[model samples]
Target chain A: MSTSADTVSMGGGNNSPSIRAKVQAFGGFLTNMVLPNIGAFIAWGLLTALFIPSGWMPNEEFAKIVGPAINFLLPLLLAITGGRMVGGQRGAVMGAIGAIGLIVGADIPMFLGAMVIGPLGGLIIKKFDGLLENRIPAGFEMIVNNFSLGILGFLLMLVSFEFIGPVIEAANNGITVAIEALVATGLLPLLSLINEPAKVLFLNNVIDQGIYYPLGMQAAAEQGKSIYFTVASNPGPGLGLLLAFTFFGGKTSKRTAPGAMIIHFLGGIHELYFPYVLMKPLTIVGMIGGGMTGIAVFELFDAGLVAGPSPGSIFAYLGLTPKGSFIGIIAGVLAAAGVTFLITSLILKMDKNTEETEEENLNESIEKSKAMKQEGKEVSAASEQHTTQIEKISFACDAGAGSSAMGATAFRKKLHKKGIEGIEVKHYRIEDVPEDANIVVVHKDLLDRAKIAHSDKEIITIENFLDDPNLHGLLERLENVSK
Target chain B: MLGEHLKGNVRFLESVNSWEEAIRESAAPLLENGSITSKYVDDMIQNVNTNGPYIVVVPEFAMPHAKNENSVEKTGISFLQLQEPVMFPDDKEVKVLFALAAEDSTGHLDLISDLSGVLMEDEARDELKQAKSEKEIIDLINSVE
Candidate 1:
């Protein structure tokens, strides 16, 4: 089967094959990272709901243990994750601090607050990361400077949360109230139109602004009002795409479409079907038509979801939805299917020439690869000589403290696993190097600095250190020499 | 029972050099009055190190108390304010400490809730912030319905 990777190489012009490879890799990376955490969170919830109320655990003791753990430990974990997401120790520390602020500063429960705070923390960390990179002193060691900058970043976040958190909280609450009123007015039809296209194109923004911002939507639902709304609300367009594929997609698409549908149904990750929709833009019109149909069905059945959907899976619908609304669920799904299938069929028929063009591009990419390979000669170094040289390894990152430390640790571990020896691995900020380092590792954006500092050194550029598995193996080889 | 026992032991301070000093000074009367033990104060300090700035759970309000067994000669509350705010490195905001000494954890819920309610009110907080004398501060606290 020709995957998107194969297609990318074939369609090459200005678009590099690596870009598509990265996108595919990140999609899998994100899924692996988040899915386990989701399971952990749900298990915690179930344990609390079942065991605490049943008197298996003492409330005071549980509060003492859970309260402090949730307040401190959870934020730290979030910071680490956030740091990994952005690629540095500083981002992780900032993320952790920001998560702490959200956890402590807001009245929302700790677990729920994490979902909102983790990303905000990532953004804050990213901002400071840029600021710190710009202000690095000319002579100081990059790692040491990053460590000091991290302390300053932590202090800044602490102050901001203390004095500024209240104002931000107030503003956030006001927005939440406004959104609740909009949702309660049953303006689903209008919202569907605006939100359907948004769901397809700008999915992340919709998740951030439309869904995650209002942390207490479930609590607000108890009051019979909430402002948060999205097309992912009921039988969302993502599900519509799945249903369309099941009923009307080509033989290959139909076979795979059911798994995507099941994932959307049970897992609540509607984005699982994004590839299918992106492959066919005509599916957008189908999504809108399905969305409108779903809205009408929701209104007809009087089925409502307390929390706005980002995941938009059947399990979340069952969890947050009011009881005994099976008919509403079914009607919404059917409406979406009806609209999507009709629209997708028309679009597919109109675009029959696209396949021929794709094949021609594929042929061109193979020719280009052959030519490039012929021009690039292979190395002729003796294996014994290459093994003996002490490879001076250096890392250049956004912040030198948190994620860099983690990366260093991972690198050392990898080196041990490889059973290689005689490597000196050290982490540096973008500009600092001891002049004799044999290998310089840096983020893609910091390549210019790496080029300037270690013009003689072999440079390995990474997009995000935390996300790349190959970097781990490379670091491991470097560490083997040190051991 | 903890609040009733500690009522006469609570002390009020006008200013202090640091949050640590404020905590030690406020807990002194409780210690002297045999309302709480010195070991309890030590534990509270240790707690702060392990857990960052939980005392400043709310704005301008800090509730510093240890476990029931730490000292607890009796239950009591202490109020301390600085002429200028003292910075706690753990928290970015300047805190005027409102330390509570409890003999046990459970009995003082009503008293804790009452104090929390009074602190939660904006007008009472403003009045508390403005008070120049210990007597004035006491009067302001007593005035909460």
Candidate 2:
């Protein structure tokens, strides 16, 4: 069982992440993309609140900023951030390039689409760059890197623009049909299933204003009250969601929820709460639950706004409330809020419980890494030497400056002299050695730092940057393995 | 570029009291020509203070450098050779110091490439300790570079 990673590839024994861990990692990536751009969304919501025709201080000209902002700016930012997360700066460029195609090609704002495309673009370029990595001649790296991205991005833009329309059209059609089928079931509360999800996707207007408001208006003409108006436009569910976040959300979400609440509940900007749902995704259950409760409450008391509440704010809700229907309307909103708050708090609490333990394990792992390092080193060193499949070797120094760079440069020269290929040798600060590096070469002097920072990897300690005996041993092992 | 940057920045010292004094004395040329500020000298010393003597790239050859952090006005390299070796931490003796003042990370890699080229071979590294003049040291670097 004790095998020295003498062949240079250190991670042959590492286990892959479990399903839950993989899902959480993906979820964390989603949260990272949405978290930074929430401020931009808030700004757009504030502008929509103040300037839209249904808004408090409606201004025709200033309101024009809303459409372009939502359609172009917010989506682009999300794509750029997502792309950068996967691909680095070039990925960001690729993300933006790919996103513009989606924006121009599709009729919708492309929020979710951009999220997908950005990372896809980043991944594309990252792979392309990886393929081109040492193959580019020394003097031509900059030109090759830029042109590869430029050409790939151009083709990606064409591909996205050419093919995205049918996909978006298909999704929009699917949502509309799902809404129609839910309405046909006559189980009014069931509408929340479609409504809540649609609302988060910026499809609020398509369902509420397009479908429900018309149906409610027709029903109102006959009976002076209908539950359709309250079905999707109830600000209760959004308010409850935000309130739950204020009390129970992650740190940044908690700090920002109060402002979002003000915009969602009072200002009637339902879009304000969309990012919160997008972040947790599971919180959509809370939204649907609150929504169904609100609709059931309205139908119980035969409550309806005589007209549609344009902005769907609490004020708008009351202003449109038929006089005798006040109690019913108020009760519906309150009930929805209470139900959503309870459900969302439970979800957030459950998330936090898992998160806290993950954090504890993370802290424990730091301490545990020392023991693991010793065990790993002994096993690797004592066992038969492994064969070479070394993909990445990181050289680390204190400031990422002197010794590490020298070591890395010299090691690269040795690798080239030995005609080794596909093994990435690079230097970093002691703490910045990437997770994917199979082996970290640190000077014997900084062994403690290397062990603490990168305990998961095989560590090779050398006394000299140029010609240490360990270096010679490693080189000979590589030569034998390569042969 | 590597030889040109070190043209007038080479000096000879008989000995230094400690590795700290060796680094300070080694980096003095960069300070005089305004290639780097005094803070960079302090950072390089602090790097050793916290990180041990990893900057001593070879057995008796030390390379002192730090994150520029706006402390370097331009990229330059300097050299110092001592007749009597100085005792670094852990009893490692260093006779030659290469003070590297890079304004940014990638700018002065050629200097490192040449330095590594010089030290990679045993005979050149041994001759480096014996090189008597600045021109001789520069030519030795050029010979391998």
Candidate achieving the largest TM-score: 2
Q: Note the DockQ of each predicted structure.
A: 0.01, 0.51
For candidate 1, write residues B3-89 as lDDT tens digits: 343345444455677777767875676677776788878766664554444455345555566555545666676666656666664
Docking class of 2: medium
lDDT per residue (tens digit) for residues A194-296 in model 1 = 5554443323333433244234343332332122332455445666677766665655566677887888766766555655655554566666677777766
TM-scores computed on chain B for all candidates: 0.82, 0.97
Q: Kindly report which residue stretches of model 1 are placed more than 4 angstroms away from their true locations once superposed.
A: A1-36, A44-80, A83-94, A108-154, A202-283, A293-335, A338-483, B1-145
In angstroms, the error of model 1 at A152 is: 3.8
Against the reference, the lDDT scores of all candidates come to: 0.52, 0.76
Q: For model 2, how does the per-residue alpha-carbon lDDT over A1-483 read when each residue is reduced to its tens digit?
A: 012111111221223432322333344455556657756754665565456665568899987887788778877898898888777789899999998998899866676667778889988987787677768888998889889999999998988888864585467556646654755564778878777876664446556644565355434434444567789999999999999989987666677789989988999988677766655567788888999999888877878775557678999788667646789999999999999999999988988955544434333433333333334333333221221236688888877766788888998899889886556888888898998888899988889988999878889999999989998888886666555
Specify the highest-DockQ model's number.
2
Find the 10 residues in a row with the least total lDDT in model 2 chain B: B103-112
Query: How would you class the docking of model 1?
Result: incorrect
Please give the distance, in angstroms, between residue A115's alpha carbon in candidate 1 and its true position after superposition: 7.5
